[model samples]
Target: MGRTFIAQRGQTKSTNDRQFRRDRQTPEVRYSIENAVEIFIHAKEAEGLRKSTIKGYHDTVRYFRDWLSHDIGYIDEITSTLIRNYINYLKNDRLPYQGDEQREKTKKGLSVFTINIRLRNLKAIFRFLVDEGIINKNPTGNIPLVKDDEHEEVQGLADAEIDMILGSYDDKQFAQWRDKTLVLLLLDTGLRINEAMSLTVDNVGFQQNTLIVPSEIAKNRKHREIPISREISKRLRQLVDETEQYFGEGSRIFMNAYGDDFTADAFRKRLNRLKKKLDIPKLHPHMLRHTFARNYILNGGDVFTLQKILDHADIQTTRKYIQMDSEHLRQQHNKFSPVRRLFNRKGKRL
Candidate 1:
């Protein structure tokens, strides 16, 4: 073969080209906090986090970036002491975003709960950076969540309140009927407002008497079937049928007058109008969910079952519903007090 040269096993034209490129390429410059946040957001999106969750991450970081005079030098420049100073700023100096007129008018500084949420979001970002080897030290490692001193028992709507709210909606009107069904659905299922709103006709299972909260809409991103009562099933069926008939065969169960999806903001505005008309100031969507959880516990439903129904990741979160049902606990204690039962038995023997 006239002295044929053999190619090395590990060497190829492509490999040599890659090696040359690697040698000539400049090392990656340290990322600024702004750059890191953008990368972090993309990472979260790739991980399939909800838009709302990703927006929260962006908002929290944006506040920090603004606090640093919009020039967060580099990711590594973020330190525990700097984070503590930001916490102090959140506690004392940071005002509610001017975008929310209600919050701006009502609040001066961030609530402990709000501050803690921002801290947790920041911690998540830094933790992600550490895991990706973007930063060696996490600035939020030593930071503790702001302690909420005013933790109060969860308050759910009473029977009278729920009845009044339900009665306010006229079944004759499509919008009214839809809102009433939504309220009933929230109360019956303990579904988050967004989850309930995102539901479509396909999510309803009249034959099975269940509502399927798809993994995409669910906060925990777990697919779960919530059993529905006959009343709710009927209402859902009617809502679905009417929505299709009126809105021209859209998949969304709830629709605006223009046949578009009923957005959360629109629902809130409707609730605000209802609040004025019905004189129920606390009439909000989440309150219905709270009502469901508390009533479920009070009506002798187990915490374990309630946890699944509410899609709570932690049993501790479900236990709070039990703790909030203090009146129910007291009634049970009164009915089954061991000391009282013992005394009664002794008297009978005597």
Candidate 2:
């Protein structure tokens, strides 16, 4: 006789019951992790995220998948515990893959700021999944960002340093004059390097003495007009005329020797060359921006206005520049102290 299969507790001798046992033995596959990542990327692209932002999301997920060794195929296999372990891995085991130099320098792992960026990207992916009803719970929900040094003094170039950089360029050479004009514009308006490079002749309002940073090129994707000084306006007009005469009427204000758009990387490399030539090791593009912010705050410009000028979405970011103007703060305190004023009025020596 054939061996008998007896039903245990909560079991029945029916065809449906037998099928249920089989189902328990082999769980259903909902979605693979790769498929989920693809879906998330498509959704983000549909939502009008920038290509760079989408690339960040894809890269973060790709790194996470690589860490899993490709064994954990299903999205359901991911858990809070696994994510915590991954965080630990980032803290202890992960090494920077930038280059041999970076790998040797950061053998301890990535910096807290970089790790936080990856964490944020991963969190965004899982949050999207939960919001779309693809996942019931977010694995990264309970995770918190690693703390960074917020009070570290902001580095802005000194007046002498700025003078040195500005004086180093020659006005006679086409490239040199263009670079000098670029530096002056950066200092005057505090525009990000990319935004400044994207400017065209029409973007400048010569009569209004303002620069119109359009929504397409603005970092925050919001349009705003920045008031430019008469000096800067003149310099910009000269650049436009020079560019037009040389390149035969191009829209872009800044162009490479080949009459192509000047890229941020090219600007960075130029700064690197200047840094070596001037022996100002800290000379870089963003330093010019920081110098602008510091000077703006010192010259009695309010943080609220600075926020708009710099296109900072948060007032808190603009407020940091206020802290950087400690010398200015001291001068204001010395000039306006009520006790000092009262003593002066009374002719008291103290």
Candidate 3:
């Protein structure tokens, strides 16, 4: 199963070859970035990475393939200079991965965070190629990552803010009913926006007080039931009852104004309108998810349970949802400080 790969520039066969078994016997395997990507992506699928993760690989590597002229350049043609050139392209040429009309950065090129995402993804693909003996060196070597500013983004809304948003919606109105249910479902269950929107009427178990997130729609590609609040369960049943009256019993739980199932883009636009109407500076499904995690931890739920509730593939991902800024820390201290618990007067013990 050995093949002769082209050598790196100015290097001998024995110099950087990890998989070269050819001593003038095996046929040389011509390797291009395009070929490597196709090979590697299949390997990724075989390795059981999530579909979304594989999609990210495809998205990021397409930029690399484009830069290298997929048909002409072999993997050995990748040099540090080519990688640097692509990094500059990401910074100066590509549109931001996620942006709004409000963000000025979207008008031109990507933000540092978005560029770093592509670079990190490139580094991963290069590492894979090197391990498989397709490339001798990782051209993405030692390139600095753009400093990401995710910490500065507000992680979760204040409890009072969440209350204000939820309470402002009047469920008698059809639009309010849908938005309120969407917000409450996200807050109570920690479901991702897509997962919640993809739910069919049968996916909800009114008697069991749970929502089934199917593996096909879940980010992790696994089926799990998210327990709903009694209030949410009641609201969900009511929505289903109303929708069933028109679309018959088995329609999607959340739908558009016209009572059709939601597409991802439609759901997002709906959330955008909800955010503006609520007067919340920022409101999105993930923020409600973070709010769920924060409140879960604050109210004595453990990280392991939070991990399962959030449907995170890793506990580390769940950990990011717990926001403990100075003000929050101070508030927690006022409630649970051991010194305050034991002392009655000044420094005197109770």
Candidate 4:
């Protein structure tokens, strides 16, 4: 669908008539950002995003729809001022998509981190529109991302807190084994909830003690083999045997009470409830993933190796979780006393 505009001709009656006649046939409408968004959705689906990620983009687009209803539908109408207002709206107003705060009766206000994630997706949407010639330029190009401090504390379960949560689980409940195993698997392997839930019994190799994730199941649709520790292997073997007794071949290894694969939301809710019950704060799935990365890097794991293990598309993304190692910090502190080094300095005599 192309839009045409009649160019004004100064003191030219004949040219005006010709342009007006041409304009009548072609509808004078701006590019629809809404339609561009739909195209973006189709494009993302074609890229083969996991079902959960596609659902998230769908929800983000749904919110964008609400945002459009308040703003205008045309891509050309998306001025910088409008984007500023939308950013402020997300920061101040409670979003419809976020879950209700457990403490408060009202919906939880959006966090800076959460806002940036949606904004990043929004950036991708407009960038795609511009590249596809759906729009002449991206309106979001000039919009600044919400900045955040690099040293900001990540929310996750500490070692002690994880122990407490694990301690609180009932060993007798079949669900407990499933849930606990899932958490441990995430911490051990850094697998996303969807990836972990997609695992089948055949993915595990008892002899080699390795978990081979196929390309189709991975987030980036790339396969890699991850080593499994004896502890994780033992737990998985028990869980697999029990699960197989009830479920036949080709069925998912993990299942909820309803015999369905665990959705990410359901897993989160269960984890949050466990945290509340255990009086452990800020426990989540990605937290376990974070804990895995942090500990792995601190314990001398290589960055390049970590990137492959985490299945990060870029090495820079892997670097975020790699903080200064404790040993490195200690060595730096020891080297800070230059006076002691000078006094006892063993260098070649000048």
Per-residue lDDT of 329 in model 4: 60
Highest-scoring model, TM-score: 2
RMSD (CA, Å), candidate 1 to true, equals 8.1
Task: Give per-residue CA lDDT, model 1, range 208-254, as digits (tens).
Answer: 99999999888888999999999899888888887788777756887
| lDDT (Cα atoms) of all candidates against the true structure | 0.82, 0.83, 0.79, 0.76
lDDT string, candidate 2, 185-294, tens digits: 99999999999998998899999999999998898999999999999999989989888888888659998877888888898889888889888857778877878888
Q: Where does model 4 exceed 4 Å of error?
A: 1-33, 46-54, 69-71, 95-109, 150-156, 298-300, 323-350
lDDT of 3 at 316: 88
Residue lDDT tens for model 3, 1-350: 44556757875555324433443323257686678888889999999888788999998877667666555577777788888887787777766543455644545567787788888888888888878877767888778787755556448888778788878888788867788888888888888888888898778888889888898888777898888988899988888888777667668887666768866677567667867887778876778888888888988999998899788888988888898667788999999888877774566755
The weakest ten consecutive residues by lDDT in model 1 span 11-20
Clashing pairs in 4: none
Q: Best-fitting candidate, measured by lDDT? A: 2
* Worst 10-residue lDDT window, candidate 2: 20-29
lDDT sort, best first: 2, 1, 3, 4
- Output the lDDT of residue 221, model 1: 84
